[model samples]
Target chain A: MLEAISDWLQSTWLSHAFISQGLWAWPMSESLHFMGLCLLVGSVGLIDLRMLGMARGISVAALHKLVPFGVGGYLVNVLTGSLFVIGDADQYIFNDAFRVKMLFMLIAGLNVLFFYSSAFQKTKLLGPDDSMPLNVKIMAGVSLTCWIVIISAGRLITFYRP
Target chain B: MEALFIWIETSPLSLWVRGESGWHMAFPIIIVFHALGMGFLVGVALAINGRVLGLAPQVPLGKLRQFLPVAMLALVVNVISGILLLIGYPTKALTNPVFYIKLLCIALALWNLRWFSYSVLTNPIYDHGVLPQKTRQLATASIVLWASAIIAGRLLAYTYNNMMSI
Candidate 1:
């Protein structure tokens, strides 16, 4: 069944059209994807740093406003990234580097959900001039590490052309 | 102009970077780290800068400092990883004007970031210290700089004259 799925994807018109068109389309999507990446990194970096005590003057809730922009970045990347898959679904689906990248992305996505569900709810301590709880700190640390790994994996995908 | 390009491309390191060897493996790994480093570094910077400029006022300023180490550490990683990537493809980046633009944007953004971090954003006077009106300008610039840098970096792949041209 899985082999059939791969064969179908390789033989599909969508893949041929996209790949042919992607000479230009690929670069454009890549550009937008990078832009989105910057947004996610920028917003997440600020909040995570704030949580860690680097910028002692910014409020936690205030920093949280940047999350929407981060989400916006993520959305842009997903939309543009799909183009690549549609263009060559089999190439990426079977690629080990691609698989690793997807794994990191999934982990990062889950980490964000975990953050909102648990850390976002602990708002009492998010007050002005209060110390962050250890759990929140841990979350921040994990989020930062996970994001780094995800980006690394994404770049690796290009090199690992299986 | 062709001679200069050739000179760069012929450099021992440049030849090694593109040559099919360990770089085949190293290139992708380093690129991944570079991307991640950018995300962490910029992500932290944007979030902190956004709040400092008063985008989100509910969270306290002091409490947000917990994430700085991550950004700083990521920056360090990028610096190391970026250098490796650069060494891997010295001519590809050196010959490209867009690459220089990306680097310049990053430098200015980081410069502006340093100024904002030390001055208006961290002033101890406001409640958890509200950011000064002036700092917002820096934050805006930071956003622009990073956005441009990322775009320019991506263009490097498309814009550069590849081995076929050489």
Candidate 2:
């Protein structure tokens, strides 16, 4: 059954269209993906660092303004990313590099969710700069690590082009 | 410079970089570094720029400055590795219009970054503990430039015209 499904997917007209048109679309999507990543990293990093008390001088409320850009970045990533998968489904499905990259992406996404749902709630929007709790700091550290892993995993995918 | 590129291509490291290593081995390792480099430079830069724009309202403006060192370090790593990769296939990248676009994006990103540092981020406004309105403008521009640069870089693989140039 699995082989049959794979065979069907490989021969699907949708897949053929994407691959043929992807000559231009793929690059365009890739460009957008990178841009989105930049957005995610930039705003998210600032907020995370604030949790670590990096800028004791600035008001937390002001920093929160950047979160929207981070969200915007994620939106861009999702849109561009789906194109790549649709264009070359199998390249990611069975590829080890792609597998690892996906793993990192999951971890990063979960890390953000965890931060927002739990730590962020506790930390409040604009808490005192020097008073951030240790848990929040830990959360920030985890987010940073997850992002790093995601980036590395993404780069490795190219080299591991299966 | 051309001779240097030729010589580096002959180096053992370059040989390995260019060699077709078995999957799940050397190739993935290099790719990991490349991705990390991208995240470091583009990812971190964007994050920092967001802060300048007033994203993390709670964080002190001064604290956001610290990330610059990290971003700079990431850019340095990318340049070195990127050069090595270029040596591995000088003709492929040099001949590509997409590659030139990527480089131009990077140049613009860096140049804009410098402007961000001087005009907005490191300016006296942060020292005064005030979120001057001007910082917001700078932050917005930074986000745009950095994001565009990343897009350009990603498009390089798809847009190259040929494998050889000159």
| Residue B70 displacement (Å), model 1 | 4.8
* Alpha-carbon shift of residue A30 in model 2 (angstroms): 1.1
Complex DockQ, candidate 2: 0.57
Q: lDDT per residue, candidate 2, B82-131, as tens digits? A: 87677666766776676777787678778877776665666645643446
Please write out the lDDT profile of model 2 over residues A68-104, one tens digit for every residue: 8778878888776665665566666667767876887
Residue-level lDDT of model 1, residues A42-83, one tens digit each, is 777566765765666555676667778888989998988887
**TM-score for each prediction?**
0.77, 0.79
Query: Which predicted model would earn the best lDDT?
Result: 1
Off by over 4 Å in 2: A1-14, A59-61, A125-128, B1-6, B20-27, B47-63, B126-148, B161-166
Q: Best by TM-score, which number?
A: 2
DockQ of each: 0.57, 0.57
- The fnat scores of all predictions, in order, read 0.91, 0.81
